[model samples]
Target: MSDTTTTVDRAKRGRSGSVILTDRRCGKRVANRTKIYDRRCPGLYVSIIPAGVATLSFKFTDPGTGKQRSTTLGIFNPETFTVEHARSRVYALKALDPAALVNQLR
Candidate 1:
């Protein structure tokens, strides 16, 4: 296979394939999964519960406490908001001044 084809294949399979995830052969739901990271963006992830609910989440450090934290961004839906939305939100968060983010958190 070509290099592009191999790369696409790898992404479809994911590294773990812990859950079948969407069908690699064809776009279809195979099973409810958990914890899938976006390779294109650090700190962005999606988790699928057994009931098939998916949520978008982002990991960051709390400036006030100097502790790491994760926040749920929104419901993750391919038709609605997905990885791209999470990545954009993370980017926006990174652009903020530390104090502003803490204030918003309050």
Candidate 2:
């Protein structure tokens, strides 16, 4: 088919979608989801999925291996777990040693 499929816009917060009459060149992968970045917290973002559920993730560099890694902090809850809390969690994880961080991964 000439038309690829549906397109979704994940820019900014809240929900956004539209019927984009896009004519893209063939043979390229299309992204269906997007991440909501936290301005105050680096590496912390809300991962949006096609199932309409968003989760919190913390990306960091492994101190022991020096390799980049990511871990799920928790579910993204505006009331209980805010961006500030996510930032604090990032700080806490940074303060911990690699071994401890592995054990403390949630």
Candidate 3:
């Protein structure tokens, strides 16, 4: 298995910017966009799609066996799903399994 990391800027003219990862080998993409109101708190805000919603999803991979898995972080809730919440979830997952959050790229 191979590990690749990518960052994309989805900052539209009047939209928030997003950073994502593109997994070349497995062809998966994960969105890692965070909103920063002040410079002091990095990644204080995060956005995630709500659960049980029809939206794009992020894939996580196992580093030991090199198996790919996908899970729904949340549904797209612009108001409820803040950047900090998303980041916290990601961090929590990472703590549980560091290799479980390998966002696949398309």
TM-score of each: 0.63, 0.56, 0.36
Put down candidate 2 lDDT per residue, 1-103, tens digits, no spaces. 5967876555643523322111121112325554555655666666667555566688777667889888887765556765556678888987888788867
For model 1, residues 8-93, the per-residue Cα lDDT tens digits are 55555643433323312122233646576666666666666666667777777888789988888887667777556767888887
Rank by lDDT, descending? 1, 2, 3
Task: Give the clashing pairs for model 1.
Answer: none
RMSD (CA, Å), each prediction? 7.9, 11.9, 14.0
Give lDDT for model 2. 0.60
Task: Single out the weakest 10-residue window by summed lDDT for candidate 2.
Answer: 19-28
Candidate models: Cα lDDT each? 0.64, 0.60, 0.40
Best by lDDT: 1
Candidate 1 lands at a TM-score of: 0.63
lDDT of 3 by residue, 1-106 (tens): 8999987665543323344421121122235432212122322222222222323233456676688755555544446653345455655666664543443321
Q: For model 1, where is the 10-residue window of minimal lDDT? A: 19-28
Candidate 3 vs. true structure, TM-score: 0.36
